[model samples]
Target: MRLVPLDIDRDLGLVHAWVTHPRSHFWGMQDAGPDRVRAEYRRIAENPHHHAWLGLDDDGTPLFLAETYDPAHSELAAHYPVRPGDLGMHVLVAPPTTPRSGVTSAVMRTVLDFCFADPRVERVVVEPDVRNAAIARKNAEAGFVEERQIELHDKVARLSFCTRGAYEMSTPHLSPAAIEHAHRRLIAKALAEFSHERLIEPVPDGDGYRFGELTFRARRFPLEHWVVDPHSLRGPLDALGFIAGLRETLGIPEKLLGTYLEEISATLAGAAWKHHHRRETAEELVHADFQAIEAAMTEGHPGFVANNGRIGFGLRDHEAYAPEAGRPVRLRWVAIRKSESLFVSARPEEDHYRDELGDETLDRFERKLRSEGLDPGDYRYLPVHPWQWEHKIAVTFAPDVARRAIVPLDAGLDRYRAQQSIRTFFNVDRPDRDYVKTAIAVQNMGFLRGLSPRYMRATPPINEWVAELVSGDDELRACGFGVLRERAAIGYTGDAYHRTGTSSAYTKMLAALWRESPVPMLAAGERLSTMASLLHRDRWGDALVTALIKASGQTPAGWVAAYLRAYLRPVVHCLLAHDLAFMPHGENLILVLENHVPRRVFMKDIGEEVAVMNDRPLPPAVARIRIDVTDEIKELALFTDVFDGFLRHLAGILDVDGVLPADEFWGLVRDCVRGHAADHPALAGRLDLFRPTFRHSCLNRLQLRDTLQMVDLTDQAGSLIFAGTLDNPIAS
Candidate 1:
């Protein structure tokens, strides 16, 4: 494949077709009309930081659309440290006319070669939706290493990168010259057309430009006219005048001039294109300059506050300080402090002590201070009341001692006590187990301050409960029972709790209560199911499914089974209705205690469900309602978001396998699609949904064609048969 710079004028129809195709829903452009497409292309053509190309096979067939943006020129620069030569690239394959093996590899190789052609470009980066294993694997085959995953646009993306060396070494067969030649052709075509158009009415004012009506304002500098086609001689004008006069100085041949004007006819036909160009340009400017603009805030400040890091300052109000003891004393200095605290520790020193003291003596003094009801850990020492000073003096023992204290003596003891109490209440002794249970409980049950007494009377020791939860091998029945009992006692019935404002707060209380309870209570099965169901409903349907899978593995079998029987229908219905995708592995299922229940009934494995979707046609009834291919793709994208969120939540509760088993999860997903395709023909040609795997890269074009053909036949048969049985079938 070769990288050909996209000629908006020549490629508009093709680009529009690709974007609005049935499989393009994930990009959220399936419903876009010609007007929107034209507008989008116009904006793309004008953006300097971003370069779009049509990936063409050797036969000159367009294989994909490759768009590359320098992170330094994208909004991501604000969050990531961008190297001058780092380029962020994205490849969106055009839905193949036929399944062609190795096409993805070919396309990627071409894109990489183009990106690395510039010696200035040292690395190429991409962030693909984490669920798109096909793309992820293809990236791996193309020499990209999986970096840390990042959340972008509320979805997790596998951020992968390829250094110039890696790209060059990985694909020995790639021809850089071929890709460059193709790109130059496309770019030259665009430049020639652009130059010719400017020659006539060469100077564009707001009213005369294509899509000008849609623009917020006319182009400010009209820099293209001056630089692309310069006619010298009369050159003493200022920047603006020189720019405006370029049109008169430059002349285009008449034959080529007509071609340029004709190329923009499609764009000029739509008002959306007019507005799109200006908005796109504005977006580009904002994205490119965001980091610089943000940095400007610290221009006169003491030091730069990195993104998400803290800034500290002090405001001294000397007027508020009072020397009198009976009256309230206010300190003049008000300090504002901030820190990332990610790795830093805050250590307080008692160096100014009442007298000379060694480290051991200081430790003893600190213990003594604790015994005397003074918190040595206190950091904020502003005295708010006169009584606070009295408490401070009592702790210090003498005026001389108080005067020699390094930390402030006027701080409020009551404030410190209250702060410590609050902190203690939130801290989980068994963080892994208690934290998950509490978060789940809170998500399902509203927090009530009054519940503290009930918890104190009935909850088991927090450490024991946490140990049991994290053991990871606990039977689903037992885990479910425990979750149910705790939630039921706290009046948390499920999604109902999430509706309450006190959900998060209540969860914290539940954790504390669980740790302190004297006896462990195993909840009834129904209660566990209800709570699990409620948690699932709080977000996207797939999210709920993933959560339930996790909950099933961690909770007792009886509780999980009972919960599944009671709540599975709602969860399943939601998943089907929303077209949610998830990994249905065996571990994801919690086996119910009932002997009559099917083994699959309490299925804990997310991998299983993912496999079911492969080559699988949506049940006829479901397919009728979800036949809009674009909508299905969009739903898949949403599923990716939901899956990521579920994993994040699970990370707090489960071990490594629970947090991210990327390969296993993606494998199940691929199986599901493949299996589903076996029975459905309509899904046969849709490569847009399933990205090619790394191993699939070795398949010859003919083999790929045959495989896709068989899958399509299967999909068609399943979908058609199902539709035939339906009373009413929707048309594609």
Candidate 2:
């Protein structure tokens, strides 16, 4: 790789074409002519703090164009708290002349090296447009920390920095074995989830497994918990091949199958991208704080095999916005008229949002309202995912913006990190503030991942009921379990979708909720984590749960029992005592830890998920939790969701790691259930119905049947697809 000085005279034609091409939107020179290009480079040549260079390969073919500047003196200076030794950079790779697979990343790595080679530079900074997910992802891989977004003249740029130490140890080349490991891990999850979903039934064949009808055969020798070992895979370690083998058997429609394949492509790409991330030991990961550990996770859902299938995201959006990408985002806020919107709050009006929004932000919002000659009283602000605004709302919902019903407030101030659910963002900047769950019309997993305006009304009220129940009950308090309340919610009933009706994505497109953050509630020395973190295994084969056990310096069973004391007991309590069951999946539950021991849990993602299993009296406000699920299926809440869904996978992890044998682990679970029952004799009548054995619930079946709309938020439980039965592990 080589860097040649930009030639203003001779290089004008080639450089002009490069900068003004459709792909060079980041260059901010799409319409510039030769003269303008000359003026820009001439300006760069004249500036002391900035320099431009043309990068080349060994044979002298132009590869990329790069500019380096001092951030303290650049456009980004006012946005960030610029420190000494910070260098700014910009790069526009000449659109690939041929089918060069990794030329972009290769050129980026070389330029980053060139930028850091300067002895005086301690950190490298860059500001790419926030929507330019391609560069943002490349930046993330190269050890950049996304600070936030800053307005840079023409675009709202995502500000990021890479320290010398971070760049030195970050983004390693993936060995073939590492790639294979990722492939095998994700494939195993696919086998388990897809089979569980009943897309194709995998029957045990001797010591191995087989799926598909007689004509087409898909087979595997799966390990404990059906984790497909890459070596034991009967055919090529083929993700696409796996789908092809099942296409006929699963009865997948061609158009839907094609789209599903695109999502699968994104999922597989995520696995490949995980190669660049640091292969930290579970021990190292266990020590990091909540958001850090969250960002550290590479995989998505454990039970759903195609967990990382974010369909709407192109490769670039995957890098910038996917939770797995670990890049920070600055949310775009908008003001929609109150008459055309809805806002609900659990807390008192002034206390619910104003404290967090602050005078400055509120003033800015009010200013936006005033500029439109509208009263602040008639408008309620909603935060939007930047990608959704650009890719969907700006283009797809352009009429709403033009009508000034939804005003664009470019991204600034707060820095949010995407959680596993993708649309939900936790404010890492203000950890104590409410988590903003926004609407993005992105096809992820099986759903179009939009927050429904119709559903906004019940969120706060349901959360209030749960929080009050937890606070009031001595039994629940004893378990040390709490809830991360969704204090407020907002949604816009756009006129474009008014006549189209509520079922469409257009009605679901613009909505948000401010769920109470788990950060502020954390006690001193207590750290929080997603329960899903327990199932993650780093490339070195260290399970995160194992590291937590080690961190607590307790035996595996002891640690698990303590965990069950907090996590399981409350869930069971809610079931038996209140006829309530949360969705209770890993992503929906939070584990609060002290010294790596789970001390308590914070239940979240309420409203839609909190189901009433039995006939019960509920006030009109809280009645949304009540579902018509029958007695036979109610126990599946604990069985399918908790035992089979979460614990089954966790048990596999613990058993395989030799932390605790399967029987002992299940025995411990039995002990916890019995102990909880014994302690709650007053509720013996209600608890009598609870038991271990349960029907196996097929989760992916719902998605397989209808990928377009996975589950209706209204008829949440009515859509369940079931298979056979599995003996529950935690039988007393």
Best by lDDT: 2
Q: Mind giving the per-residue lDDT tens digits that candidate 2 earns over 1-732?
A: 678888878788889999998998778889898999999999999999889999987448988889898877877767878888889888889976744445677677788878887888899988888889988888887889998777867988888889998887663444465566666666666776666555556777666676542112233211124554444555456666677667766666766888767667667667767655545567777887777677667777777656677777765577678776666789998888777888888566556547667778888888877887878877777889989988988887688788888888657588888998899998877888878898988887788888887877888888888888888888889988888888888898866776576467778888988888887777899888998898887766679998899879988988999999999988888888887888888888889998899989988898767877667777788787778777666677777788777887788778777788877887888888788778988765564334545666776666666677778777877777767666666554
lDDT of 1 by residue, 1-732 (tens): 567888877887888888988776555578888888777767776888887888876447878887888788776676568887899997778887843333455466668778887889999988887877777767876689987888776568777788987865553222343233222222222222233223223344344332111111122111111112111112231222222333233332343333222222211211111111111221121222211111111101100000111011001111111110011222111001111001010112233221123355446546655665656554211111222223322342233233333233222111111100011111112212211111111010001112222222223222223224323422323223222112111211122222353523332221112122111222233111111221121101123333444444533233333333332322232233334333221212222222222122222212112212233454321232222344333333322222222222222122222433433333333344444346444544443334321111110111112211212211322221110111100011
Give stretches of model 2 more than 4 Å off: 1-181, 194-224, 347-353, 685-692
TM-scores for every candidate against the unseen true structure: 0.24, 0.76
Measured on C-alpha atoms, candidate 1 has an lDDT of 0.34
Clash counts for the predictions, in order:
72, 0
Q: How much lDDT does candidate 2 score?
A: 0.77
Q: Residue 572 in model 2: shift from native, Å?
A: 0.6
